[model samples]
Target chain A: MNLLEDTWKLEFHSGIPVYKQIIHHVQAAVAAGRLVDGDQLPTIRALHQQLNVNPNTVAKAYRELQHLGVLSAEHGSGCYIAPGAAEKSDGLSAREKKAKLTDLCARFAAEARSHGISFDDLVAQLKRQHPA
Target chain B: MNLLEDTWKLEFHSGIPVYKQIIHHVQAAVAAGRLVDGDQLPTIRALHQQLNVNPNTVAKAYRELQHLGVLSAEHGSGCYIAPGAAEKSDGLSAREKKAKLTDLCARFAAEARSHGISFDDLVAQLKRQHPA
Candidate 1:
């Protein structure tokens, strides 16, 4: 509760939409092991109150997460992280994995190019992330 | 605009929206210098006819580009790549550049984590891109 609140501080001037920010935060939380399978998320109404954002915004974020297979919503039981959703490494066929990797690389390249980051600079940074 | 058509072959089954595909292509074109400042983009109607996508989708992409300061639209004319927009490296203040870099890195890290790409593997692949 409080931890969730602390982790998901909304920056009003970040120029990113509230729902998008929520989506990113939730994904980051799941990636970091802060949220896990079968863990229930705050209801849209509760989150809206906590964040002072529109209920529809929270609903939108939840719907998007559900669509991505990261969250599963029950009619009356609320939302839980989908089973085995955190580990995308599992269940993917070799060809599927390769396709995902290629797609990610293309997206990374596009983003890097847009930010004016040269391939050399990107490689340098990647190297820095893993020394020796 | 055959070149544009060729460069922007849409994949309806890619699980990405048409407008997002359009946005990515436009950004890539700008990064590659294929579209420069003052280059007029196809009109919404023209693009709709060419791509056979909804005109609203093309308009949405153009509006997003304009919001990003990547494209400028005239009332009676079509969209143009915004002057000095391609080179984000030029006008960014030191703080802004650092912030942007940090944001990009955070996004990259999140994406990598989701894809189960370890730092070591990412670094290895990056090194491959830069021999010697």
Candidate 2:
């Protein structure tokens, strides 16, 4: 898959709002450097069709991203990744960072349990995610 | 901490709605058997104070859980974990399960990155979560 692909994997069962999830996906992509400054995103209509969600939902996500300074919009044009967004990394304190890791691990373990992924198999997958 | 403790470690920066996060925490607790049927939940005001979130947020989460049949309410008494909530597990298909795991891993990786957690450290933590 292309790093800049506009794929928005929507999980209806996650209990998170779809628009919020879209914002998360875009932010994560930006953090990973898969998206960078001035990179145009899919149009609201296009993204709506791609995700099978309401166009308004896509628009809301875009608007929220713009408000967060993560996206820039031009009149009658589309949104692009914002400048200096990549520089927003590494702002968290040590305690905040530890909390994030703990929260993430707990969430991952819970999902693995629900998916019937055994502890051993989960460890194997985790190793693959970070090969030596 | 006791499994039934009403402590909610909320991550305000996660972009997930606070109320939804509370709902997710409760559902995850139930799924892990840390919370079970007949388990009384903290009252709205109590949880609001505990998490330092709005009381309405806690009430909204409880209402949503009740609607989803995960919680039962009593007029004067408080909410309790609903019966048969545990048996509601494992209804997902293999494909759906795989998608969930993929989503989870990507999320974990993104968080691990933002937290400046080295891949080695992350793998070590994952290993600790699943001992022989």
DockQ scores for all predicted structures: 0.12, 0.16
Candidate 1 segments whose C-alpha is farther than 4 A from its true place = A1-132, B1-5, B89-132
lDDT of 2 at B70: 87
Query: Which runs in model 2 stand beyond 4 Å of their true positions?
Result: A1-7, A90-132, B1-132
Which tens-of-lDDT digit does each residue in B1-132 have in candidate 1?
333455468878755568877876776677666778888888899888889999999999899879878899999977888998777543444345446656676677667667765454454344444323
- On a 0 to 100 scale, what is the lDDT of residue B80 in model 2? 90
Model 1 Cα shift for residue B32 (angstroms)? 0.7
Q: Which lDDT tens digits does candidate 2 get at residues B15-130?
A: 55788778767766766677788988888878887778899999999998898788998978999999987665565544554466666776777778767664554554565555
Cα shift from native, residue A59, model 1 (Å): 19
Tell me, by TM-score, which candidate is best. Answer: 1
- The 10 consecutive residues of candidate 1 chain A with the worst lDDT sum are A123-132
Task: Estimate, for each residue in A56-80, the C-alpha lDDT of model 1 and write its tens digit.
Answer: 9999989987987889999888988
Best candidate, lDDT-wise?
A: 2
B-chain TM-scores per prediction: 0.65, 0.65
Indicate the DockQ of the complex predicted as candidate 1: 0.12
